[model samples]
Target: MTEPGQGQEPERAGSRAERLRNWWRPEGTWRRGIVLAVLAVLLGIVMLLHSRIPNDVGNLGSLLETFLPWFGLCLPLLLIAAVLRRSATALIALVLPVFAWVSLFAGQITDKAGAGGNLTVISHNVDADNPDPAGTSRDIVASGADVVALEELTSAALPKYRDGLAKAYPYHTVQGTVGLWSKHPMSDPQPVDIKLGWTRAMRAVVTYHGQPFAVYVAHLPSVRVKLDAGFTANQRDASAKALGETIAADPAKKVFLLGDLNGTMNDRSLAPVTSQMRSAQGAAGDGFGFSWPASFPMARIDHIMVKGVEPVKAWVLQPTGSDHRPVAASVKL
Candidate 1:
């Protein structure tokens, strides 16, 4: 040996390296905590800057907004992991997403309890290929809507819906693929051209309880998002613009639009309609009230919008053997 403590120094240095490896190993809980915290940070960033996400690629921003509510699931899972591992770091990091999500969506939630409304109205897109038109019509009648607007009214199912609702409504009119039923007198049924060559929209004046109001029913052309073209459905956009123009031109002091617009209020593609009218759901619904893909609704594509009426309640109806759930709203004329 060269020196008395020289060999001992080498041994201590080797032990130090081993200890360092142990501290930085994959099995450490601290590493897991760090990962969770980083995820939380990423979520916070996404929530805060969602609008910046480019839509040119595939209308990715709108697609994200469509299912944005699901993002809230992250906080609970992170909190559970933190509790199980006693991870203070992850627990504290959860505050990021909590604040982020709250800031973005909290304002949308509100109380909806009310005494009642003067009129009940409903809208639906009973899928043209529905197998049981009778059952669907029965369910809608049971909903007790004073005025009902129906879209996607195919030749095969139109007669069934008319006969099924005749007794209850007494007054009805259908123009093109859309129709309207009311418990009061109806006048001047006209087709609204949505740039579709053929008609898929209509308007009428429904006189209920001595008050006549303009009602429009439409089935906007569908939109598609593909790998090559993004969410560019030129036809639907053109139709929406035309519909907006027609509504703007109408002379009625009170106007209501009911339809399967195929786009949510949040989608920029619907700016024309959303900008012109106030959504009954946005004003009075208890919750998001999504009404599509009847089995598992993820978006509120069906709508009841009003220009000069006051909505007192808004809600989504149960499935009626159709792909889209019916939407209902009560209002004061």
Candidate 2:
């Protein structure tokens, strides 16, 4: 072929690119299939680098990270679309998300079960409005956890909680709306000031197997994301900070914090606590084990964190008439 003029090369290349774009979204092929493929790859990138997103829009980074793993579900859908439409470009783009999804989450997909643990800890946010607090407490007690921390212990339900847990766990303490029950002896149960003008958090020392460690139970103030304002929980953020300070300053050789933090580990607002301690679920659980919205479990708000302890297993329990499911973890003390 004869060599094209310099200006003609640019025009020809532009025409070729236009033709390629048209082919990518040709009417003969499914237009949506092409778009879906690109979207799937974008989801992978977003999940992998969600931290880079600005949190100014209601802490958007966290909102995405909270459901990051779920984004992988779209990959298969895109692949199916590409196959049904027989679009080579779309099919090839599928590789991006397939690997991206695997790279970002493959490590978490495997199950690490059957490991023995010296201690079992569970945390739950018992909805304050729960009609049967006693039944709820009974269900948690039946889990056989060595230590149990419960949040949203309303005044009306406190008596029922005390009565229900007294038989299985003789050692228990309640501070504000948070409470802890232990099979072992516990002491020094004191309220942790989280600047909520109320006792929503507390710390206690428990002697397990003749070894003592500190445990903290907290119910951080609620956070709201409204149309006008984003993550409107100024109080919750402050409460988390105060709780983190308490955990950091703690003199105990070992520490365990369990409760409803009202935020996920991905949320930077709770970085104070997440930074200092390790999430039991993240360390050993089979899956995300979301604990909130008991009916569906879309996010994990109930948590078990530890310092100076190793997690051997972690899991989320079924709903027990509460708005949140119970989270349990086995630890090597």
Index of the highest-lDDT prediction: 1
> Please, what are the lDDT tens digits per residue for candidate 2 over residues 1-333?
656574787899998877667764556343546676677668767866778998777767766766677788887788787787776667777787778778867866777654779899999898988988888988988899999999998888899989999988999999888899999999999999999888999999999989999999988988776788765767888899999998999999899999998888877779999999998888898887788899988778889999999899999998897989999999998
Looking at candidate 1, what is the lDDT of residue 157? 92
> Candidate 1 lDDT, tens digit per residue, 31-62?
54777888888888887787788767767777
lDDT of each: 0.86, 0.85
The regions of model 1 sitting more than 4 angstroms off are: 1-32, 82-89, 107-111, 228-232
The lDDT of model 2 is 0.85
Q: What does each candidate score in C-alpha RMSD?
A: 6.0, 6.6
TM-scores of the candidates are 0.84, 0.87
| Residue 68 miss distance in model 1 (angstroms) | 1.7
Clashes of each: 0, 0
